[model samples]
Target chain A: MGRIKLMGLAVSIGKVTERYPFAPVEVPDDYRGKPVIDPGICTGCGACASACPPQAIQVKEEGEFRVVHLFLGRCIFCGRCQDVCPEGAIRLTTEFELATPNHDDLHQFVRLRMVRCVRCGRPFDTYRHLVRSLREVPFIEGERLLLCPECRAKAPLDWLEGGGDGNEG
Target chain B: MGRSTLEGRFRVIDVSPDEVAEVVRELFEDGCYYATGMGVDERPLNGRFAVYHAINCPKRGVYVILRLTAPENRPSVPSITPVLRGAEWAEREAHDMVGVTFENHPNLERLILPEDWPDGVYPLRKDFPYNRKMAGTEGTAGVRGERHDEATMSVPLGPYHPLLHEPEYFELYVREDRIVGADYRGFHVHRGMEKLAESRMTLNQIPFLAERICGICGCTHSAAYCQAVEEAAGVEVPERALYIRSLMLEVERIHSHLLWFGVACHLLGFDSGFMHFWRAREYVMDIAELITGNRKTYGINLVGGVRRDLSGEKIQKTLKLLELAEGESREVIDNVVGMKELIARMEGVGVLRRKDAREIGVVGPVARASGIDTDVRRDHPYAAYGDLDFKVPVYRGCDVLSRFLVRVDETFESFSLVRQILENLPDGEIINEEYSLPYMEFGLGSTEAPRGEDVHMVLTGGENQVYRWHPRAPTYNNLPAVPLMLEGEDVADAPIIIASIDPCFSCTDHVSIVDAGSGRVLWRGPLLEGVERLRR
Candidate 1:
């Protein structure tokens, strides 16, 4: 009697398993899988690098360019990069089967040109980052916008010390 | 007077090194269970090494933290293990990580680190390099295998057993097919996570690292860490965010309990029950993916609020899945309970008395099953638990069956909680934007993880980094109770009894191994076959 009842219940429940690989996998709407980066919008600001818990997304400066490296192995797929991205360039898409033979294949990189400081002639940040900043906040523009943080802050102080009005700049 | 954090949840008391044991003794006599103890190298900040013992007074609904300071040159404090049996592992861990010496500790050996690791270098100290690559040591320098003894036979279980996914060594001393004594050596999965949190990550980054501490209850750990930081910073989370957190927590709980149930069934040799339970568990996993994005480690938590918001459609979808899960789980549990063979195996096996459980300081279903009525969600309300009403299931059976039943009941309770949280979720921002924590602030946060109470203590540091963050996983408090549970059980019932605790080694870096002193290696290969031979 017990065996019959269990079988009846099991039959009534029906099949609840999903067929994947054979069929296209079903993921939720906002499923955080592999993060896709749009190089066009990516400024190489290193916000994602700072925000990433595992240090998976790394922003490395190579002389004149900033390289944004995303190591898929280290990513816990938390979507914090999406939340913290100022430019909305990085988004987690529904593509999570990230297995690869080579270790380097797990890494995704985006390179951006470095923005040199106008006053000091040193590479300070990415050019796209400066452009994005200029477009977002227009109040701090003109000569000061082209300079790095150190040069920008010092430019006004230098003008003041050179017997010129600070407002002249 | 020291600064107070977590509002009134934790009371900090700072003392000199000599007075450490005295203070802990008083707290223990006053009925406080040792929650966790740690040593911190404060040489850079205060030119002294500090040791903290967090004692939870459940009855008073408060945690009393005993902090002691020893001079940098001689970092020594009196051990509380002599008085409180639960402080044994915590003190040894402190000794291993921070190089702090506990004067009267019975065994002051390396608890977390490999025995071959160089002495006088502590990984957790401020000046130690976080990412320094070192050469691997040759051979197992300190693999303490059990030596031969006359009357009793030693049975070795793991360092790598089929029963466990992670590495843990357990030596069980059995005499004529009955376990007399059990010894455990673990911490294989310790990836220096706390050190990584301190040096490599910012405040925003730590949550993700915290989540990965245990793949099973990753969200709960992240939530607990976030709550600790939020408390320290006095960040008032939105009601909607709190509700969302509660909902996700419930969803995670249901899935975890079901996962444990399936695993328990497999251990009991009930393959069909395991398959059915896992099938039902898929629905809860679907709900989690729908709400928080991923199935397992739902990365929805941030310091102040959740990263994801629940929409009306998401809520409706979750409700449907949760209902399905509840129905299926109920059917499966009812059938399993009615089975005479299953009941007989679980009913009186691995019996843990209420008095022994309280003394050993077991938590979650293990404690509840033993008739010690303590649930962190109800006792110390966090998230949206204060707003919601739920029963803390208590069973006095004090056996494996009672533990199983407690988890089964919790699954249904969690289903109702998910429904209530969705219905009552307030309208507001999910993540708080305008909260800043000053340096030197301390806070204690405790969340009732599916296994038990998981507490995180945070000391906010400079440059948006935490100075000291200690995450006490539920298994840390519960694993100590296993040996006591295994005291007089049949040798064949060892696997099921150990699995009854629902141990998550990744969450705790915890494990057990049983070895017989006879020349034969019991754990040579194929654990199931080895157990079968032993059974015969």
Candidate 2:
């Protein structure tokens, strides 16, 4: 009797299984899949790089350039990068099938121009990062704003000696 | 039971290493199920190591935490397995990871680490580097299990068996057809999660790490972790955030139950039932994807709030999916329950009596299948579960059928819960902006996963990183009950009996086996080979 009912139920809910590759299944609106980074808006500020739990996104300094790399193979698609991106540069698309023939295809890299410190004259952060930071922060302004964190710390000591003339907030 | 006021999440009783057994023995007599034990290397803060044994005294509505301190140089403590049998694996795991030797432990061999892992270098110790790579050859000489007599033959069931989805080695001692004794060795997927959480990741990043602890019950772990940090830092999660967490938890429960039901059907050789259940479960996956943006490991849980919000239309869509899922699930379960062959195989096959269930400290449906009624959601409420109304199904059959029924009932209950949470969804900010994590504070958070209670203990540290983080998955407390259930049962019934516990080996994937006599290496699982390959 139960087997008969089961057969009837199976026939009623006929062909519910999806046929993928041949017929495309509709993904929901909020389906998080592959991460899409808006390179145009990305400032290379390293917020997403730092916020990534798996360290899939990283800012590596290579000689004169700072490269923001996203290793898709290691990415869990948690969207922490999307959540932490201050510039709204990262978003998760509904395209999850990211398996590639080459390992290089798995890596998404963006190279940014390195900005040199004002006092030390050594390359520190990305040029876009420095520019964005200067514009965002109220205290950082003028040429002193272009200084690296180390030089910025010493500039305050220099300001005490100069009676806060040039580097005043 | 001895009464103690609740201090945060647990009623902690500071005891000497000698008194640990006695206190735990008293709690056991007073009807407390042993939850889990954890070891912490507090040498940097207190110059001593600490071992904590957690007790779930739900009858008295309190969690008793047993704390014992050992000198840093000579870290050793008495084993609580003699008094409370469930502490067997947790204690061995503590010994393996933290090197806090359990003095009277019968098999204090390596539980998690490889056989050739260097001595005196405990992974959980503060001095050990998080990313340190250790080199070892394949199948190096390790602790050979107990030597068996001529009467019993030791048969290896895993490390690589078709019955198990993940790698876990179990040495089954048998006389012809009947099974006599069993020994387990797992922990293939340790991944050094705690060490990574402490040394490398910040507080915000640990949730993602917690989510990956188990593929099925990932949200439970992440939610427990977030709640632990919130409790430690005294962050009051917003009402809307709490509601969303509860909603997601129920959604996860629905999908997990469906998945388990499908697997159980497959194990029973009812492939049609399995297929239909899985087909019904896809709707749940669809609902999950609609809400949290991922089918599995829905990473919406953060410390203060959820990352995503549910809109009105999404709620409507989820309700429709829930109805469809519930209807299909009922049809499948009805058919399965009426099937006499499956019922005959399952009923009274693997009977874990109420007394033995409490003694072994089984949790979730396994414990509920027996007469020991306990649900963390009801006993100790977290998130928005307290406000929600639901029934925790309990069965007295003490068999595999009862375990199956408990989950089937739970599926319907979870559906109602999701509907309730969606209908009464609060309107406000999801993330609490004023929440700040403090330094040098401890908090415990437990969420009732689809299997059982998954507890996370967190001690806050400086530089926005956790000092110590311990995640005790439900399978840790439940797996010990397997050998007990396997005893006296037929070898044919071994797979179903083990699967009856809904064992998530990856979540509780640390093991080592023991033979009856003159210990010898009987079998090594795929874990050793995988680790060896990774190193090479």
Candidate 3:
């Protein structure tokens, strides 16, 4: 009983240590270090919507499943989405190294996508950088952003007036 | 014999460690800043780790690589900490992760690992587990004693105790109000990231891993990894990809320095400057979002080329973001300089004399502020940096204020570089076909991370599996210098002085106490002499 009491005191007083900085830090087991998305398994479900306190989740429904977006800045790193994940698709690892001046960078969700142009039948957006170029104006609000497919086909109307695309001419 | 940079020329020499040490001593005597700590690996043919302890002479740069072998059976080396005071932390880290124990390393406690770890488990060991959470296994960070001094009643700075903004630990050896020694306990946030990159991950997985190294220099980490891998495979990043890499790097620099400025402001108790600095940083983050679909991880960096491109519209938005962010940043900096308390507090505190900084081999803003004119971007041209012409800022004052001024100056340089990369984005593919999953190649990657230079060395091996991989982050190297910087300083100057070294500190706690309660024999904890021999 005395040992137990002392152990309790030590625990409360932060007297114990762990393989910290080595592995398994003095963090809660549920501590969400960074959000990792297995692009292969993620169904793009928007289940993480309410889970995010920062409302960093962004999900766009293409055809069947809703795409999820996460802004790390807004993300409280609660890993509420990982906890709420029905598919068990998201897991939070102890990866807290997320520093950047760009807000868009903090919103990165670990996901994979098949590249396709908006206007053509070709798969030109193999790399996400190409897609990022088109995301400047965003198709929302009728912004003149040139999306992948429309920008390559050389149609002015298909792309937003000024997004990086072939329709600039 | 090798030539010392202090003599005013780039001198390359072929010599052993004995010769190298003599040359280094010669250069140190002449007063040159130790630029950066770099480690590289050569494997398959023969497993050897080549380490570089660089120095920046006033007009010339000093870089020397010493190749050593930490055979899988016996990974150890003679400690240079006795000779080079700056090498204290880096050497300990080299021992911790790579399992290279420096002989006679005065106090070779596990620098990065927490005290409650198991023994013979170097987290950075090439053979160490990356993501494999083997239940009931031990870590090398088995520290036995404490990070505090028994005399002064050691106070652990942070694992998240609030006096600091980052996760770093310092063992303050205090004698009254003054600090006798400050030992850095870091790498608490060790993700086994490099090991993950080398073993389980593909080249494509590196950008993500790179981003995890430090939030402050995400782009630089990814860019350097990309550049190193590309160079190893002899793959040319598309011209557009190069431009994008530059853009990301500059944007990253702007955000990082601004963040530092805010932290500095906060440290000085200047709340208004702190808020304003972050407010300016927000605009930069907005621009980052505008260019990259997601904000921080950009995902723009790929193996061969950038994943993202900038169109004229995005470019225009960039122009707006740059104009707004830079303008706001300028105003905030102006306010910061005008703050009397901040200026006074920072001026002479943490004075790493131009002479001492040169010997310790520090890097980035600290080096520049101390009058060492060496920037990897300028010396070793990688990516688009070869084209851009910017003056490397150097201030003669080797103090906290000098580092602050240097970072502020760098913010402007970053803005200008962004504008340059944006305006002159070449017309070519952002990514090339050569970027096919690199399967078999020995590649080296190095980039100037925000804190300093981040270098990753990779050797492609059998079955898409890396035979050997080595990663060197700026923090792993710079952590050692902090203790030395803290020695002979007052405890009151602790916060700003620590900020001067610019540690990510996310993985370290300042106070380390042995849990005599938890009886698990940590490797670093109790170097019990030949317990195995006793068992036998």
Candidate 4:
């Protein structure tokens, strides 16, 4: 009968279910799970924030700080942040046991100090981000990087006329 | 007056509003069936509204899309439902979502929106913000329960039934244990995904959202969406990427079919069969996780090509897993076919004739079982399916058993497809990023999902966003046939009959309230009693 064969198959397969809670389960090396950012290497460039589909990672300017917020609650585990991270600062670790009782536990805020514009005296780019940019493009004058994007765009016409050796600091 | 070709798979034709029905009727007569319909707000483009009806011409191996536009002030178009019955729900949906009026539609009620949703304020319009929250109106569109005089007893199946996986309300009018008429009301978990995709999500991000449309066959949605974008932008996906996409799709089919078999067995009270089938299905899931990192939502598809490539070692391991999955699945299915009790339960129950199947426009195994002989993979091949060889099993029984056998045959076919894809995968780049998006171009992408033909329509916009993106799942087309299948069938057979379509209600939000002539409530409970009666 079909029942006898099914019974035989069942007996042969034995217990297929895993003892997950009582015993540790092994996941594949390429498992996409909880994405964490290495704040030490991160330059607060906000590339991951712009690349995130769910907006789980967001960059905001808070007074003198550029805050990159990563909310685990809204994360769909797509690993897109890791893909777009310029400095390899974000990595999706195989740590998917992210259930929590407190809402604050799900949030990770990486706050970087912002650099003030030389002319406007307003918070412009993050200090580390500007430094990283300067490192990448070393030919650009550091004094130009000190000014905000708005101030840099509208620099003195006299400086443009004397472009050969204007003001080097 | 203009005609154009979209990626060589779709032929687009623009028609006036009056000739829309006639053209769709002529196409229907010419061996073409309704695939899907979409309504777009084109006020921003050319100061008019547009409606698109996509029909599949199996004989020609192309999908002919009939497009018609109406003036901004009078956005009205002729209804094609009178000619092709399958266009009923789709036209009503367009009316509800985009504020387009389908003149002479039989029942153009609120198909997608909730009863409390205010009228005349369409959520998919150009002006409506994606995150806008409107207060529920007082009795705007209340449920109209028509009292049929013939049926004496009214039996309500769900809004939440033990048998159903998702929330759906089905009202069955029964007279002395024989069902007379049935009505369905669903769409509880709409989530406003289309609105969100058009308004907020960019080109690449929509693929992730599309993958979440159906929990079981999420990859097919993502594949279809990516294909639509690729077609619009004319991106040349590498040969290796195509093979990988097909391989992953077959793997997904194997797991989805096995899952359906387990659920079917559980519904039939054969718990042992259910457990064994699920046990066998684990191998396919393992293979998916090994390849795509995640098991269910294999988030590998993007606009140009796939995100991951199959290395030699991974391909070897996948073949091993496929061997195990195919062997175990064949053993269980062979045993299941020989079981008289299980066969008797499904044999002649819930019969849907070939005529009704065509009129309803069913797809996948359901249509194949009814002898319609249509498969999107063969008729209009996509995602490396053109190079693969497989058989689409069809049965003329037009019953539940036929459907089961069709899927059984398909599971084996999928195994062969996986092997072919892995062995013949070309060496090249996995993803291509060199393509530019054209403004206001239409594209269609379709995949033969486990349930049926899953179609996604995309209208490309500037700034990396879709002007309108409509995804029509297989369940949307197949669910309309359930009421007809339930009619004249025994009350006890309702559960399996509905499940026979492999109905993914979440993929469908998609139904039930029973009203008698006297408007009296008789039985309000699960259909466990009917199953108990049948068991006795």
lDDT of 3: 0.60
- State which candidate has the highest DockQ: 4
* DockQ values, each candidate: 0.57, 0.71, 0.02, 0.76
Q: Please report, in order, the local distance difference test score of every candidate based on alpha carbons.
A: 0.79, 0.80, 0.60, 0.83
Per-residue accuracy of model 4 over B1-536 as CA lDDT, tens digit each = 11111348998899887778788888888888999998999998789989999998988899999998889999999898999999999898889989899899998899888888887999888999999999988846455446455434567777654454466777777767777778888787788888888988889999988988877788899999998888887888887787788888888898889987887887788889988888789889899999999777889998878888778899899889889888888899889888899999999988899998988899999999999989988888888888899998999999999999999999999999999998888888888888899998888999999998999999999699998899988988999998888889888888888889987777764211211111122223457343211111
Q: Which one wins on lDDT?
A: 4
Kindly state the fnat score of candidate 3.
0.00
Q: After best superposition, candidate 4 residue B463: deviation in angstroms?
A: 0.4
* DockQ rank order: 4, 2, 1, 3
lDDT of 2 by residue, B1-536 (tens): 11111125677789987677888888888888888788999898889999888888887767788889999878988888887778887898889899899888877878888877777778888888888888764546656546466767676777654344467777777767577888877786677888888999999999988888877778898999998888788777888888888888888888888877777777777767877888888889888889998788889899888899989999898999989988888888888888999898899978888888888888899999997779988888777877889998999999999999999999999989998999898888888756566787877888899999898888899578899898888888788778878888887788788889887777775221111111121222331232211111
Please give, for residues B399-453, the per-residue lDDT of candidate 1 as tens digits. Answer: 9999999998898899889888888878878878677877978788888898898
| Top of the candidates by TM-score | 4
Residues B84-185, model 3: lDDT tens digits: 666666676666566666777788877655555556665655555576564444444445324343445454565432333345556566667677766555
Candidate 1 vs candidate 2: the lDDT winner is 2
Name model 4 segments beyond 4 Å from true: A141-143, A157-169, B1-6, B140-147, B509-536
lDDT of 1: 0.79
- Model 4 CA lDDT for position A73: 88
Candidate 2 TM-score over all chains jointly: 0.91
Cα TM-score of candidate 1: 0.91
